[model samples]
Target: MADVQSLLDKGSNNGGCQFIGIWGMGGLGKTTFAKALFNKLRFTYEGSCFLTNVREKSKKHGLDALRKELVWSLLGDKESHIGNAIYPYTMSRLGRKKVFVVLDDVNDHEQIENLVGRHEFGSGSKILITTRDRQVFAGIKVVDIYVLEALNPNESFDLLSIKAFKNDYDDMKIRKLANELTQYADGNPLALKVLGSFLNGKNQEAWKSQLDKLQKLPCREVNDILRLSFEGLDEEEKNIVLHVACFFNYYYDAEDVKKLLDACGYSTEIGLTRLEDKALLDIDGGKICMHSLIKQMGKQIVREESLKYPTWCNIFWIFKKSSEILKKNMGSIEGMIMNLSEVEETRVIIKAFRSMPNLKFLRVYGNLNVQLRNKLNASGMMFLSRNLMLLDWVGCPLKTLPTTFKVENLVEINMRYSKLTKLWDGEQNLVNLSKINLSGSEDLIELPNFSKAIHLAEVDLICCRKLQNVHPSILSLHSLHCLLLIDCKALTSLTSNTHLKSLGKLSLAGCSGLSEFSVTSEKQLFLWVCDATINGELCSSSGHLSKINLVRLQRCEGVTSLHKLVDMRTLGSLDADYCNKLASNLCSKFDEMRALHFLRLTNCSELYEVPDNISLLASLRQLDLSGSNIETLPLSIKHLSSLRSLTLNGCKRLLSLPQLPPSISLLHVNDCLSLETLHLPLMTEDREGDEFSPEKFSLINCMKLDGQSIKAVEASVLLAINNNKAIYFWAKWNIREKELQSGSCIGLHSLS
Candidate 1:
């Protein structure tokens, strides 16, 4: 349901500020949305960042590199961060000039922060981000959020008509076929667009048969249908994608995945060019993506081929062949790690690195206490002591690094899951570290000086229970992003007043004894941020609340109802599990919110009854009335026309249900079996609280209702009468405990 004519018109450049988000599910016009938005603003920008797949970029190029790329591009791809004297040099080059950036389908909170951030843009600057996650701009004030809901019935028909018959067919025949195709496409325009164009001149029965087959196939079976173009690939071109997936990093330069395949005697440079022409794959950053959907199909074919020929695959003996390439290229090796490697892969890997005597960085599948087997009387450290830049043994037990190496060139040493109980005892200017993950270091207490790693971008000390110091030295690395201290138990006061403007994802999930959060970063998500504090403290007045649980807020003494929460409309789900004092009456007032879908009000003990006006919410879909003292349903509950599921489980005191509207397609009433009376209406009774309204009720299940209670009943109702079942009898007696003197329910999980 969409109007394309108004889409570009609603995009804004008003008030010297513009916030545009291109939103949709995967493959449903997300990139198309970005391209459409770009055509609208092409004349306004001098430089543009057309970075595709923001998620894949960050995973490959570290976050700093991505940010620097943007800045560099704005200044004609020159210097990244200008020195104090050259700061004005870079700004003067870019100032008063508008640069439009389009980060296509960016999927992370941190990527958005790095891409645009809160710093005000210059007068003519506009930053546009396309994302599948609407919450990307949740906390920030977006000038316009163009939500790409599916096409309207007429629009869907028009789009397909243009694609299929292209104004050549009879109007009646075209409309009829388009309507049937629309039902299978389910309003997803991409599928409609693709299938419509493909099936245009086909016979009617052929189209119908395809739709019927599609309906039976599960989601996993949809890969080929989505990427049927890949099946035309010759055996040679088929191996290109398989070679890339197994070992290529995010930006898998075609030349790179090619070298591995070339070594395997499957050299297919001409074949690759042919596949790209067919659109089965595209060159992204000089690497192959095989198209997002096509890649899925290739993966399936690879899996099937792998199982059929166990020793070989799309690339013959991929791992063994890869080991040969790495071994042959070892003369120029700088650093490497092959942790947890299997025996078969290990031997091939060993042969590959055998030539790298000049290697500086190294780690592989071997016990920490074992000495080198080859170079007799030499320590493992001595074997690797030249020109090392970085060393990472992610989940290995390493007691020491190469002490004889020139440690002065060392920048980063990731011993995250290692057994190193002490920091490397070095006094050299450790100038280049930007990230260190000591997440599982059991005995680590303190860290190296901040003066050393002045460029650190992230530091993770998660699960280091003995962590007590806040590490004043951390103030030096002004560019840190992810500061994960999830299970640090002994942390009491977390204070950071540095230039932590770059920080994004912060998780403090299970730190029980921790109390105060003095950290000032761009964004933070607290899993449990309150105090069982030895001093009983609470969180800041209001942190950037995105997705949060109940413990994030301590005693609800100061908080009233959520009125300003309407601005947080991007919120999709909320869990207020233990907030025993919060009332459902206060929560129900959020009916004006159009995007609020999921509400979990599980343990609000004092939440005795749900408001009768809850049906006023046109957007309410998944409602969990579980674990409350709610006794009855209002006839007015039939107004919620969009609700697909109604869960009344564990609302133990619920004795009856409102004759639910037909919009409820999924019903979970396992705990509602105790309800003595389950009366469902056949039509809408929401307008007048008198009888069946006969407009909106399309309920699926109501075993305890009389034929009179269900007005306008259809004849196909299936009735069950088992030996132990007596619905009418229990329907009368289940209302006795409704007047019990129950205590106020605390920690209600209501997501109003």
Candidate 2:
């Protein structure tokens, strides 16, 4: 309520009318919040109206009648003409009056536009709309959008107790049952209220039975309200909802789901957006999530439909049903998820897939038992649907895919850790293929030509130890975004014949046998060649490396210089740690990389000195030269204004420090065993008029530090304690006890 008030205040400052949207999933108390806010602010306006059940009322009486009701409620028996000209009528009649309006449970933008129009009310008029769909305020200039969230655990339990026990709060068994019911409600207020009412006088046994039933089926009242949003969706959107509910909801993210649905020939992008707007599903942190009750409702819908038709189920997630269908060769099944780990001795005829011609999505969870896996191989699964869009079979037992299975409509094929030698005999028309993941397929040695898979975006072949080479046709894929070949030890080279225009990420890390790698993808943003055997020139065409941002070449011993990366003007991070054979002048030309922010050269013992031009990296934020042989930093290092973290932990060579930048907040010189002098940044005023100091300073094993360096460390520690700033300081135990006792701090430590 306080949040809504703040929004209203902000809207009032914008002048004229304000429209604030309250959006969330069903039963999340969207309408309840709007009603409470409406009552609180209604008396402040000259005229106010709260229109409830806007979606249902609009459906029954049409937008025309709802518009009339909105006008009449505000006008209140005043003789004013109302008709198709309500937009103008409201403006003319209520133009000078400050009105407050609340439209509850709105699902469509048209409902709000037809009733209120765009900012049509008089000055100071405020409109509050509660909706399940945020898209309802599409073209309207809403002051703010407040997304109502589910109640927390404490709130859920409190609400449940109020409705169920009515503040009785004494019975342990009933309270336990009530707690379990609250968990089932999952913070939904409507579910809590309905369940609480239903279990009011029921005994402990009855409550347990009710909980069991709730687990299987959602409460009718809650399901009915939630199903309204599902029913409003079109066929494609409904299918997406069901897909998430049945299989992909918790298992896959939005991108994975999109690829599968796109292969199924659905407008996945728009359909997912619609579902998100309707609050039927949420894409939180890329994961598609549906409320527990809403998911139950979707599954129930599919179950009800299956009950009616018996043989024409769209999805089969139940292991028993899927196994039965596969054995019986049911053709009506469009999608199926089977867990082979649960099937102990059931003989599922793999050849029956040929009978299910409509099967589009097939995900089979494999058994880890060696005997069961061999049994699966003995079953001779020789047939697969050519219409399949997604084939996610983990631990596949076959040595090769069935020759009868076509790859025309396949979009994604994920057979990780499978005992497969190859995908197919030759390249088929893979025009619709987008992603292929055969990671952990140790026995796989080759890949089919992807010349026809022009739309392929990702190819993950990680840990495929036997794979020797990638097909040359992959270089022609203009839409390839990511190609990972990590730990493929037999992979010797990845040479491209043409420019990969859309390639953004390419990883050849741990490919020990890779002696050569070259690509012409100018748009490549991330390149990982760690632990490879590439020597000398890293790239054959270094002139086209402009937009590459991150490059990892850890442990690439033969690479002597990073001269090729001088052209990477946009390279922000370079992790070339363990490249011990790199020349001292390897980073001499790194000044040309204006965007370089993080440079890690850990354990690179050959690096002798950093060039004076290092000060030219104005954007460098972190400089990690730990375990390097550099004795001293360039005096110009003080010019790095953005350098925050400087780690020189294991530089054991004799050294004296240079004046450091004020922006250096973390300094680690832990094992610089040789004699050294320290030059910490002076305490000065920062941009915000605060005393600047490094948050952490470590010199644990610097046994040869001069007396002046020790005093400087003590002074900085005292300053940090005086200013009450959080600081960490580590030094040998010879420091003065009197200076340490003057002001105590948390991170200050002494090494004995």
Candidate 3:
């Protein structure tokens, strides 16, 4: 416990309602920090009747109630029904008072925007938010953010000692026991309390045995607590929470969430606000993070509710279900079966499958047995004999697409990954089939009569190790947008037509023995990983190149200069990952390639020096010169406004990283075992431009450099790199995304 005097000392010594956001994972006591801060703020907030437990009641309270409750409490009114109350009543009062609104357990952004978003309160009227979601506080004005880290081993022992050892830390025996117990808890306060409570009355041996069992305890306990948190939610709020926990999970994209919710019949923000107020669900970072435990509990509740009603989750003799929850045209499925074989495989037996006879987007997909067993067989082709487009059965061990299945309506087809040993359908006039994927089916010998797929957008034969030929009629697919023949080792060349402006992603990597690859596309994400030279004649300078990766194409003899690398503006990442031919300062013209963020010329022996102003491209973040002959960086490297990581692991020619930007906190010169000298300056503060002396940069693992410690780095220009990994990551590093729960089934919330 910090001295209360120190808490007071850190307070009001500043101005305005200090917007403090306390963040942590679900059980790390973020709400506890907010409570502690509230205890300190109570004297200042005389009108404080802290709605102690607002989170668990979110669904029951709804948004209107949430706004009215906070407003009413501040005004000392008890009646909860808001309609009887007058308009602008809470607004006018909050406008005058320096209120402290601590919306604890906020899970959604919309919830916060609904609760306190309308208030035009004065400056000191702080809105202290505590949430598991840290990114939710982005864009909102949070003056000070306190991330609630897990308790340390000592702190954890202290907390447990109070509960188990009767606050006796001086007792040597109890102290040792407390340390052992702390190890089992992994620094979680909640777990420590539970273990301490359960093991208190037991003797030392029982405690040790329990500790062993507790060490094996997983996240189940944490989830149980979360489940209990939602069990406290009101019924209406419960419905809303379950609705979101299931169907609207992936649709957390604001517009998508709203659209799906509207489709499910809740057309207004009322349902969302209703769920928000009870503290059952809060929004953060524009996504809904229904506590993992709460989501599981919600599912349990849904299954129970469905069972009780005996309709929604149909459990008649076979547990069949009908759902409209999946996206209409996507390859999405709903309903879980105990066993696939036991489940109804025939469309006629299932209500959901049988009702939709006019399925528009049918694609062919099945194994070799499904194709060979049905090629001449009459009954096996009945299911796909009508309106079908986009036939993609690439990896489906298919001998060939059946000739008996005369397509009544067909468009795109993908047979790329299928193992087709032979294929032919001499039928004519079935000209509706388009795009085909015969990519990895190396055993395939012939094509299904190609004139039918005249409108085909693209055809991919990538990794079809034994791919033989492409028919001339297939080449006439003028609308083909993406053509991929990557790694077709036995494949030779493309058909005669060279103009394919609609192509977007063309990969012909690893065609070892092949002599040529000739294709003209406007914008293509091409990966030429082959060892042979691509049609050198077709490598002319023109059109847009969104992305180009040339990995291990060592036999490419013609492409010596990169000046012919066209369309720099749209180029996203140029992966010269192992291009030994590339030398530093090779391509100097495209200085404004803002989209180029990752440049890897690792293991390129010919590279000596990078071009001047190469670091001017502010978007570059990761530059790996891991195994290059780079000697010195351009002076303009200091201008790399957005660079975060610089790797010089194998840069034998490189000696120093002086003049590196202060914004750079990570320098992976880990394996640069070469001659070096380093200078270090201790950075007194974290804000940029605080003070950058010539000695602010230092070295790590630089044994060849003048080995200097932080003790000796006192008076250098480069700031002594904080030896603390905690401050290094917590202080300045920013991650774009975190592991999140982005999976939510839509069918669970869809109504009958």
Candidate 4:
């Protein structure tokens, strides 16, 4: 509501035709917001019209009729007959009138363009659009694209309470059930209302039973509305959505899932983007997130396919059903995942694969207890489907794969914490394999030859303690992007002969015995050599280091300086924390790192002062100098327009700080025993529009702050309050009564 009003106000000032798009998932109340906005602003315009369900209306009554109706609504005339040139006719009639128009539930760009021509409305006119497809607004001159988010927990509870109990029921048990239902709905307004209405007069036991049933089946009304988005997807997108709903919903990284899907011959990059744009799936914090109801809707789609012929389902995840299908040798099954954590004992027959020749994806995962591990056995397993594409088995019990198992079609093999001493006797056809993860395989001493796996993109061998050497074939993979070998204690050296053009990330952290490391991948973006014994010269000798964006050298005793990286223009993050052997003057050429955004030099005991030119990193956003030996920062730090966070905790040697930038939003000076002086920009009324106040200010254990410093802190708090921003201020000493005279100490509290 606030967003729409703000846009409308801005449009009023600009005096021009304005268009706004309200977009989100199906059940997020996009239409409700649009309706409220329309009603509130309609009285201010000369004419108003709301076209509801434009997508459905266009299909039912045709676009011509909707266009004619729009014209008649704004012109206040009922036209009997209108010609095919409705675009020009409607524009000519309505262009002189200031109006408020809304097109709700639009799904395609054609509907928008055909109904309302480009910028045809008069000056001071406002047009609002609500849609599930964000692509509908492409190429249109929209002033703002407001994405409506789901309700928060409190709002969801209040809405559900009003609908179910009419704000009268006060039973604690029923309220608890209502809270659980709201959580299960995942803040979706439509699901909350549906569940609330269904359980209006039901008893406690009925609510519990309904909740239990909802876990496996979504409400019919909610499912039908949400499934409209799913029904519009293409076949490949439908398959991808089902894959996430059944297997990878918030369980794995989106990149890993994308790799697997791409290997299955789907256009995953574009498909995932399109799904996200449609709001059926969300990629949050690098994980695929889907609403609870949407997930259940997708799973129900698959369940409906197996209603008559149980063996014809495309995928299975329930342990009982998957086990039954496997035992019955259901050849039509394409994928199955079995989690063994709930089972006490289970036995797999090795010959089951011979009957199910169509299996493409198979995964077995669980934290098997000691008794279950001993009882569960696959000792005689000898055959696997030749058409297998993905084989992910956590805690695999096999010592080696069966010799007859073909690897020609395998796309990914992930067997973490396995008991395998080796993968196979020799290399087989692996042309289609793209990823291999054998991390935590302590007993594994070597990797299989991957010379023919030309498409392999990632290989992870973290914590493979006994793995002494990497196969030479791995270095020749031209398509490899990530190679992680963290904590491989016995691994001594890694040398690459040819240039790996596609390699991007290489990590050798915790490899204590690593002495020699070299790579020729000029396109590498990240390199981690933390806690390793590799010589510093090896890093400096890499001619392609200039292209790397991040480099971690923590606890690297042999390193004395980063003078060698003076020319890395692309380096954005440099972490040299706890590098005790680092020289006081680590790197004097900070001006060369034009792209540096994060600089962490914490616990670098030998660092006495930061380079004066450090202020030249115009893109730097975070600077951490905690537990260092610096006494004072350069005054030029105030010139850093992009720095937002500064950490100076445990800097016992520091005596004072300089004026920080107005962009700084966080400042921490905890335990700074020698901190006697502090400098801050004075807050005044003239700087209202330009001020950027700190959201968090910490002064714990800084007892030496003088009276001037305390006053500055108080003024900063008042400024933040005036800006209507939440501020977290922590101080160990009691604030003076004079400082609280203006009520600036409302949110300030003592940490002591």
Best by TM-score: 2
lDDT of 2 at 100: 93
RMSD of each: 20.7, 6.6, 14.4, 7.2
How much is the lDDT of residue 693 in candidate 2? Answer: 66
lDDT of 4 by residue, 408-484 (tens): 98888889999887888788889989889999999988888899999999999999999998997897788998999
Per-residue accuracy of model 2 over 359-402 as CA lDDT, tens digit each: 88877775746776666553244466778888888887778875
Candidate 3 lands at a TM-score of 0.46
Give lDDT per model, in order. 0.53, 0.79, 0.53, 0.78
Report how far residue 455 has shifted in candidate 4, in Å: 2.7
Stretch of 10 with least lDDT, candidate 2: 681-690
Residue 45's lDDT in candidate 2: 93
lDDT of 1 by residue, 1-752 (tens): 14332443454354344666666544457677677766766666676666676666788876666777777766565564643123555555555566677777665667877666633345556666776555566655554566665677777777777788785667575467668777656556676677778778877776777667554332343353444334545666666654443333345457644543554456568766666544445566787764334444554555455335533332222232355444343454333444333324334443533545444444443332233222222133444534444455565554444344444444456667656555545444656555566788877766655566666667888887777765666743556666787778777666554535555555665666665554544333223332224232222333432332112333332233443321334444445554455444455555554566766666566777766667656677777666667787677777777776676666666666666775554555544444554554333434322121221122222334344443223211211111111111112222121221112211111110
Candidate 3 lDDT (Cα, 0 to 1): 0.53
Q: What are the per-residue Cα lDDT tens digits for candidate 3 across 227-332?
A: 6545654554455566566434432544434543453345436655545543445566766655433455565555555445433332111222423321132122
Q: Write down the TM-score of every candidate.
A: 0.42, 0.74, 0.46, 0.69
